[model samples]
Structures are given as structure tokens and as C-alpha cells.
Target: MRAKRCVYVVTAVLPLFLLGPARPAPAADEPFPAGRDRFSSPAADERFPAGRDRSWPLPGRPAVLRPWAPPPTPHARGHRGVDLAAPPHSPVLAVASGRVSFAGRVAGRGVVSVDLSGTGVPPLRTTYEPVRASVREGDEVTAGRPLGTLEPTVSHCPTTCLHWGLRRGRTYLDPLTLLPPWLLHPGSPVLLPVLGVPLPPPA
Candidate 1:
């Protein structure tokens, strides 16, 4: 698929304001350990630091309608990523700084893939699907930069939604692991003194 290379220089920057409110993620097409809740943090997610480099892929951090459920084998039936509830044409932003590796279609659905900078070896690549891309392949994009808008078409969910995926080479992982707690599990918006607000006790 040799398409023309196009560059997109983003002039307008978006503030990290999303952490709005998304419905709690629900386990889809699989069963979890009997005692655990669907949203329970897995051990793999504990290693990630709450770094500033990451941001929500969508405004308001849309509801994760379908959580990642990996298959025992690659060819088995399972969701490779997550399905986030979104409206048609909502902007889909980058989760981190990266170069757009591929911005095209797959199985009749628009898709975008980004190879993240600084991640070791085969760099972590984030993917967004059912999106009509505004940025083209090889373009460098910053976190929160618009990659495209969710296409107004049939979605895997009952309503329109965006499929968000992340991978390191051939391995699949939870996309939510990239988000910091504040953005992944934000409380109601609040205002406090920036100078010297009292800190909450250490967890």
C-alpha cells in the first residue's frame, strides 16, 4: 500500500483536560476470576509510572464498553483491544508522542497506527480504528494531537464507538495501562490552591 507521504504540522495544541467521566469498563466476551471485579488492576499495569507523556485518546476519556480480553493463542477469538463509547466524528487524539506508521483501512474500517518514541526495542505502537484519519503516515504527532475523527459507521458496539489498541511488536496489551490514574480514574473536577494545597496521604 504505497500511498503518497503527507506531512501535518499541528499548530494548535490541546490541553490535558480529558479525565472527564467514562462508564466503568465492562468485561466483554470472557469471564474473569470469580472474585475479581472487571475494573480490578492487573499486576502488569503496576509497573507503569504516572508519567506526563500519556493522555486520553479521546476527549472526556470515553467509556470503555469492551475491555481487552486476550486469547490463549493469537488466532483464537478475543478482543485485541478496547471499545470506547464515542459519538460520530469525535476527534481521536494521540495517547503519546509518536509517528503515524499507518493510516488506512482494514476490513473496510478506517485505522491508524502510531509507533511511540523512546519505548525500547520494537517501540510500543498504539492503534485507533473506525477513524477517518486527518494525519498521514510518517507524521510526528504529540500527545493529544488530533489523528482523525471517528467515522460515522457501523461499530462493534450497539452504538458508534472507537476501537483503541496497543502493542509491542506482535504482543497485545491493555491500552488503559498507558494512562495515569488521574486520567484513567478521575473524580469530579475540582479547584484548589495551586501554591500549597494539602496533599492526600500516601497510598
Candidate 2:
């Protein structure tokens, strides 16, 4: 009887000790492991500091009414960049520091492109369209630098909006990903603890 009682206690007590304390599990949408930034990426950090090059093309950080929608293929129909709601002739700003590769007309629509060659591989480029060029080609510009003014021209949005784009060679990337967390509405991530079998109650 004594040996049997001891066996039961040992089984129960050992399980409690091994079970350890309960903690929240990692959320499904958590981007980082624990202490890292939610939108941090090593590749982005190497090119553009986390959230560094993310200024709205329009003044006052205008709302992005239409988001980026990349096409399945290069020729397929798709929205390459984000469409920020802005008034006609609104000042357009550069999202990052770079040289103006092109600041001229394309298909009757004024366009501006900044070459981000110093930042990353495949030579990234940021383009703003339907904008009257204020800076000339080969001019160096900094973040928030006035590139041009929004011009009323062709746009994917129903209303007047600045079409902001990012590209790596032939591939177009979502410009919002380059923006800071504060500029976006990626909501708080939930953390859940790793689940293990529940330990039996202590005898």
C-alpha cells in the first residue's frame, strides 16, 4: 500500500514539474520572432532603413484610396502602384533620396522617376505619374523633396490621385510595404503560447 501510494504521488508530481508554466502562443500574423519590428526585413534594411523611405507622395500624407495591384504577367492588365487621393496640382514629394533619372512627358502625362541604385540590388526605381516635373533629370533629391505637382491626366483611380510606383528591373513591387508602420493599418498582432498537454491536477 505504501509503495502504491508513493508511485501515484510521483507520477502526479513529476508531470506538474515537467509541464512548466503556461504562456501565450505566437499569433498567426506575427511577423517577427519576438523583439523585432513587425514590418522589418533584412533585405529592406540593407536597402532602405525600416520605414525610412515611406513618405506620402502628396502633402499631409494623403490617404491611399487605391492600393497596389500587380498583374499576373508583365503585359497583363494590373495597377502597378498605389493611388493616393489628392487635388489637382498638389505638390508631389519624393519618398527617398535619389537621383532623378527621368522627369519628362510620357504619352502626354508628366512623369518622374528616381533611381535608387545606391540602395539595393537589381537597381530599384520609384516612379510617380501624372505629375508636372519640377526637378530636372540627373538632379539629386532627398526624401520629401518636391519632385513635381500633380497634373490632371490619365489615372487608374476614379478621382484625381497620384500614382506612386516602385520597381526592381521589370518586376513591380507594392509601395506600401516600403512605408512605415505608422503609415499603414497592420493592426496589433496577437501572441499565443505553444500548447502542450495539460498536466493532471495535483493529488
Candidate 3:
């Protein structure tokens, strides 16, 4: 009888001893935040739009000629920006309201960068290349303002297109994040199932 009681007590307390105290249940109204392993979620999509009512550099939601494919290293081979399918001489518009940081030629191709302030450290700068400038450096431009005309002088694509790039400091980010109707948002989480137990049914 003593042996049986000791074994029972050990079985009951061993799990608690190993696992420690239980965590409090999350609040009913509180949002379950996305974890650091958000990329592991099966339902999580790859791309997400950045802002609401953001205009495209080219009209009519132009298809991407070349998508953003960041390289392993800065100097390695990669397409840092998306090449939007646009006709030659097509008007390139500003995607957001910001001051024109640069509007000039680089390596024989015209380039324009808008200094969008208050975004992050180094500020967010939107870039368009192979465009003949209509805006100049230090110009205050509104969203959808005409920045330049798309030129094929430096076209990377076999066909004419606009190379749209977004940079915060030295890092390049997907420019499409500026488009509205976000595909992903923080603070929304889907519960993952436990390894050995059945998942709870939807409420």
C-alpha cells in the first residue's frame, strides 16, 4: 500500500515538476499575435500589400515583367526590383507623396528617387529607372504625380518595362507592399494543432 501511494504521487507530480507552472489563458478580446515562426504557418501567403490607396507607377495595375528576386549577397546576381510591363514613352507616376530626392541619369539611364519621410531609419525611397525625368531633385510631389516617361534606353527585359524599386537604406523591399487590400496583417493568428491531440472544432 505504501509503495502504491508513492508511485501514484510521483506519477501525478512528476509532470508538474518537469513542466513548471501553467501559463494563464489569453484574454478573450485580445488578438493572438503572429509568432516569429510566422513563415511556418501553412495559410500564410508570401506577399503583402503595404498601404491603402497607393498608386502604381504604371497605369492599370501593370503586370510584373520581372519580380523582386533578392540575391544571397549585395553584389551577387539578382533582380532587386520588379520590372512592370509598360510601353515605351508611357508616363511613370509617383506611387506616394514625397519629395523628389534624386532625378538624374545613372550609368546612361535616367533614375528618380522620392524621399518618403517618417517611414523608417534612412526613410523609404521609391525608385524608378530608365525614365526621362519630368520632376527634379527637391521637388514636392503628390501621389500619382507624373515623375517621368518610361524609356527603353536601359531596359533589362527583352521588351519595354519600368523597373520599380523600393529601398530603405541598403536593403530592398517589395514595392507592391504599398498597394491596398493587405494580404497579411500582424496580430492575427491561426491556432496550430498539437502533435498527439485532435484540433478543436471552429466555434
Candidate of highest lDDT:
1
> What is each predicted model's overall lDDT from 0 to 1?
0.75, 0.70, 0.68
Cα RMSD to native, each candidate?
Answer: 15.9, 12.6, 15.4
Worst 10 contiguous positions by lDDT, candidate 2: 28-37
Give the alpha carbon lDDT tens digit for every residue of 1-203 in model 1.
11211111111111224434555545546433333222322354333445787778899768877888765543444677888898999999999998999999999999999998877768878999899999999999999999999998764788999989887776667888888887876785554323333433433
Clash statistics: count for each candidate: 0, 6, 1
Task: Count backbone clashes in candidate 3.
Answer: 1
Candidate with the larger TM-score of 1 and 3 = 1
**Over 4 Å off, model 1:** 1-50, 73-75, 188-203
Query: Model 2 Cα RMSD, Å?
Result: 12.6
TM values, all candidates:
0.69, 0.64, 0.63
Give candidate 1's error at residue 198 in angstroms.
Answer: 30
Q: Scored by Cα lDDT, where does model 3 land?
A: 0.68
Pairs of residues clashing in candidate 3? 50-177
Pairs that collide in candidate 2 are 24-192, 24-193, 25-191, 25-192, 25-193, 26-192
Residue-by-residue lDDT tens digits, candidate 2, 1-203: 66666665576556543653453321222122233112222243333556455666777768766666544333444556777898888999988788999999998889999986466666678899899999999999887889989997544567988988887666567676666766654455443343453544544
Query: 144, model 2: CA deviation in Å?
Result: 0.5
Candidate rank order under lDDT? 1, 2, 3
Best by TM-score: 1
- TM-score for candidate 2, please give it: 0.64
